[model samples]
Target: MDRIGLTTVVFRNRFASTKPKNQVLEDELTLLSTPEYFVDRFKVHNVEMWTPHFESTSKNYLKELKRSLKKERCKLINLQSEGKFDPSDPLEENRLKAVIEVKNWVDVAKSLQCEAVRVKSMKKSYSKAVLSLNEITKYAKAKGITILIENHSDLFSDYKNHTNIIKDVPLNNIGLLADFGNYSSNPVMFDSLKHIAPFTRLVSAKTKDFSNQMEHIPYDFQKCIGIFEASGYQGIYSCEQWGKANPNYDYEKITDWMIDNIKESI
Candidate 1:
């Protein structure tokens, strides 16, 4: 139960105003205040920050964020950095640019003293992803930060190809960020979860719909947790409720349900 934490994606509505072009909302969660909110509201010490939630990456801003986390005694476990650059782009110049963008985020993760930074496997070419991750992983390794490739979209949807990219990289600091609800079907989802469980450093316990009784209905949440546990995965289950942005739903209650689900399953 203590292993359960919160990802900022669960509070996307509250954070929408932080990004550019989004309407400023009355109730907003800034990067600096998120740590205290998580501790006060959820009693959790670990946080996985989304890239869009960050207002600035300046040194002073980062220092202030560090102070906020220290005051609340919370740890920044992972940074879900979704930069616009595509590492899997075929162009050499574009690939180099993408590698640089990810390296910058790696530096940010290092500055925040986070354990890992999650990057996307964009486009369809596995060879191109390998080319970019090779450089990104080497840079991340030197800073004592782990590089995580998530089953986000594009080529990563295929578990075999995703694992192959990791195998080709051959770096100790590079690993997987397994999400429970990212696959296509029930069988494939479970099989992919089991296949990648051994290489996963962090788990995104993604939830979408819940029954009136507060039971998760999209898939077998317990079975997903069991699969990872059976594979000897010892990592934080960062709770992420990724559903439609509904104003009626009580996010706090949903998060509590997810935390309880993961705890009971474990």
Candidate 2:
């Protein structure tokens, strides 16, 4: 149970102050105050921070965030380091630029004392993604931070391609961040989860919808957990409720349901 955590993305609606005007929700929560929310609301100390919640990667901002986490007795276990740049771009200059951006996030993760950071491969070329990840992993290794490649968007949505990218990276610090709901279909999603479970360092327990009774309806959520446990995965299952685009849903109920389900499944 201590391994359970929640991603800030589940509360995207409450982060109006940091999000863009079009994306803002009804409430607000700065990254500095998120730790307290996690502690008080969830009764958990582990946090998986979404990159967008960060006001800035500046040293002073990171120092303040660290202090806040310490004050709340919370641990930032993972940083979901998202960006627009394509790390696997064929163009050398473009790829290097993306590499630099990810490296900067690695520096941020180090400053926050996060155990791992999640990144993505946006292009189809595994070789190119490998090149970019190698550089990023080398940089992260020195900081004692692990680099995670999630099954997110574009080429990585396919399990074979995603695992190949990790296999090709050839670095110990590089691993998979298995996401439960990133695939195109139910069969593919479960198959991919099974294949990547052994390599997973963290999990994005993504839930899209729930029943009135709080049951996960998209797929067999318990079966998903069973697969990872069968594969010997014993890491943080960061709860993420990626419901429909609408903000009218009950986020608190959805999050509570997810946490309870994950606890029961594990």
Candidate 3:
């Protein structure tokens, strides 16, 4: 059975605020859930973190987090690093800065004992993005963590962009994090998933509106799982849900439904 996991983005509403690019500002009333919260609430053994939900990446913070995860017998599977870093920035100085920022997150991921750290692709220029990721991969490889490129932004949604980088780089440490719904509800989502499935190390099993009868409304969960199955992807299908999208639905119920659906499929 594929391991089920939860991403921190599922509880976006619980965060303190979304100002200055949706990064958690770490203030009172934030209601940000801790690693233990997910372990206790959902009973999941695997966790994927989106950077925004975290209050800090200091050594002490990460050390405590790792201890908490171990205490609960939960594994930190992947870290979605700050999305603001763009390795393809046209400005030479900015691109260098982006590398440093992502490198720092790589170190952070290492501290947390995460298996992989996902970085956003630079949409403007593939060559430059490859160059940037190559450097980042070297750093991540040294730290014993895989570097993942997700199908997030428009360029990454194409799938070929992801394959192109994977081919050009030719390093085992580089892989893809496939997200089912990031292509704006495109019809070819499954095909795109098939194309990139071979290179996928983890999946962002994104979910949206559900029916009153507790069925997934926005995407075909079974067919997507079939694709993953055929591709031999035996890995984490991290539940990446947005609770606020359907305010009327009980967020906890919806989350449980998503996890159950994936568990049944796998």
lDDT (Cα, 0-100) at 120 in candidate 2: 52
Give per-residue CA lDDT, model 1, range 1-266, as digits (tens): 46887999888777864323554564688888899999998899998999888889999999999999999999999999877679999888888888888899999999999989998658756898998898899999999999998898568878997788778999999999898877788899999998999989999999887766777778988889999999998888999988654556777899988888888978
Q: Model 1, residue 238: displacement in angstroms?
A: 0.3
For model 3, the stretches where C-alpha displacement exceeds 4 angstroms are 17-33
Candidate 3 per-residue C-alpha lDDT over 34-129 given as tens digits, one digit per residue, 9 for 90 to 100: 567776778887888777777887777777788887887778888888756578877778888889988988988889889999886566767778
Model 1: how far is 121 from its true place, Å? 3.9
- Tell me the lDDT of model 3 at 160: 81
Lowest-lDDT window of 10 residues in candidate 2? 17-26
Best-to-worst lDDT order = 1, 2, 3
| lDDT leader | 1
Name the runs in model 1 displaced over 4 angstroms.
17-24
* Deviation from truth (RMSD, Å), model 2: 1.7
TM-score, cand. 2 vs. native: 0.94
Q: Model 2: per-residue lDDT, tens digit, 61-180?
A: 999999999999888888888777889898888888888888988999999999988885576567788888888999999999999888886778888877886678888998888888
